[model samples]
Target: MKYLLSNLKIDINNKIYLKDPESSDLGKRIIEHSIQLIDDIGFDSFTFKKLGIIIGSNESSIYRYFESKHKLLLYLTSWYWAWLEYQLVFSTTNVTNSNEKLDKAIDILTRTIESDSTFAHIDEVTLSRVVINEYSKSYLTKEVDDENKDGYFSIYKRLVTRLHDMMIEVNPNYKFPHSLASTVLEGALHQHFLKNHFKSLTDCNQKVQPSDYFKHLVFNALDTKT
Candidate 1:
């Protein structure tokens, strides 16, 4: 699996970036530092100029890769989802039982992230933190409808569809597969946020993981034994 994943390339929507950040050293640096900068200062305070200072490049050079910080955020979040989709596909490909496949999918989606060494330039762990902290900013905007039409959210939607299909496989009679699949994905993020900030609002803690809660929720909803 590591060998297969070492050669993996996560494709993002072309419209999300002015240039592909994986194409050159400068471009990769833009992506690498941008993740760190965003995680450090957050999406609201992150800027190309600040990132340029960190990477020792002119702000305009960064602009050559991403038109704006918002677009960069889209690229980052898109990359994260695409990478996660690969993990999901690889992990569940050989599971013969439908319920087991769905169980693995939930684990992959809701579990805390660890750094992946395959993509050395981009830290998956830090990027996951960025996604948990700022993913909503990528789409919660007036331009989201237009961007959705342009396929910026395709990878994310496809991921939800994958989970939705798994839900149907587990329980063909289930009426709300799409809604439940989306809720598992989106709710995992919300739960992670609450676990970190509003501790009283979430049941997930040191002993209880978000994945545990979600797995229980999903199995019960499907009338399946965990």
Candidate 2:
């Protein structure tokens, strides 16, 4: 049997419904509900019907926002990118010194890793699988051009490029590729949070914090020979 996600009509634009700005708010709420549900239950177990119940809407209402579950997941991925943009912009824009900027960047990374509120307990493994699944699909636009370097890879590349330039300014001796730094950051995140969540591999016995490990990785990477 089918269920209702939201009773309101939403315009999914480029989909079955008409474009309506009024639907944006509800659409965002529904996506947020989806994220929360994914955290509460595993992503594999999440469904539109379950989301509708959580959001006090119906499946038909959700159709107004998105035609299908896959579409909703795509929206969520874009939302995740937008949210990361928010974090990076705020963290990096105003810093005057290169060292200070790197410090701030690492701090941002730390917070992203440590906070369940930001990542919603979704681990890197599950997220990677989701990204890979979408990455394999044909792109309607050139936005997702690179097979290996799309989605989070694209986001991370941008971030690391900026941060690497800053590091160069701070230390003329520093010579490392943006990909290297990006990989380090990704590895740190995966080890601290993502792997733990998806792989069921715990890094610490108990009460181990990602921020602590993040600081260590940052120092090690910066201090080591490039």
Candidate 3:
């Protein structure tokens, strides 16, 4: 767990923020409060005005760090994916088997998240619920093309590419490594959403973990017995 050192920083895209929130005290406060607010009220109802009251800062102060609420949402989602990439790297670096590495990666994506004590201001567990519920709002917007062009989605894509690369290493003839990698991620989020709101759509039972289903889906899709 050396990767959980106090100084760990996840790189978010510069285009999303007017100023790097992690670099200043007030900026960090904004991020922390934003996470709590978004989780409490949901992203669509969350606003800098409400956040300002909670953080004891005016809306203008929050605006200095983010252009708009949408940008803040993008920043948060981007931060989560980048942080997940870091976790993936740290966890898999010492593992030797390609298939085992892939399994580890899949489990990381599908399993419940725990707060990393490395970053004092970020509550990864709460941020994860926000991600499962609200991360889609970051990209399911009219501005997605412009946002994509600005490199807002690179960290997530890079994470998927890393897993896809490992899949190819495990099976050179695999035809849809990219598809399977992305599916495991999106599918996990969707399953969590279902478990929260529409229980009929998911089987979040005690014994059958989502990771188990995802592992089967991935290994079966790859035509490999694990």
Task: Give the Cα lDDT of each candidate.
Answer: 0.93, 0.52, 0.87
Pairs of colliding residues, candidate 1: none
Over the stretch 1-226, how does candidate 3's per-residue lDDT look in tens digits?
Answer: 6456445767888989999998899999999989999999998899899999999988999999999999998899988888888778889999999889989988888888876777889899999999999988889999899889989999989988998987897888988888988988888888888877887877765567788889898888888876
User: Which window of 10 residues has the lowest lDDT sum in candidate 1?
Assistant: 1-10
Cα displacement (angstroms), candidate 3, residue 207, comes to: 2.8
> Measured by C-alpha RMSD in angstroms, how accurate is candidate 1?
0.7
**How do the residues 106-200 of candidate 2 rate in per-residue lDDT, one tens digit apiece?**
66654433232333333433443344334223234364545225342354456566656756665556556465466555555555445445545
Off by over 4 Å in 2: 1-23, 112-157, 171-175, 194-208, 224-226
Model 3, residue 100: C-alpha shift (Å): 0.8
- TM-score, cand. 1 vs. native: 0.99
Worst 10 residues of 2 by lDDT: 1-10
53: Cα error in model 2, Å: 2.9
Model 1 lDDT tens row, 104-205: 999999999986789888999999999999999999999999999999999999999999999999899998999999999999999999999999999999
Q: Which structure is stronger by lDDT: 1 or 2?
A: 1
Measured against the true structure, the TM-scores of the candidates, in listed sequence, are 0.99, 0.59, 0.96
lDDT of 2: 0.52
The candidate with the higher lDDT, 2 or 3, is: 3
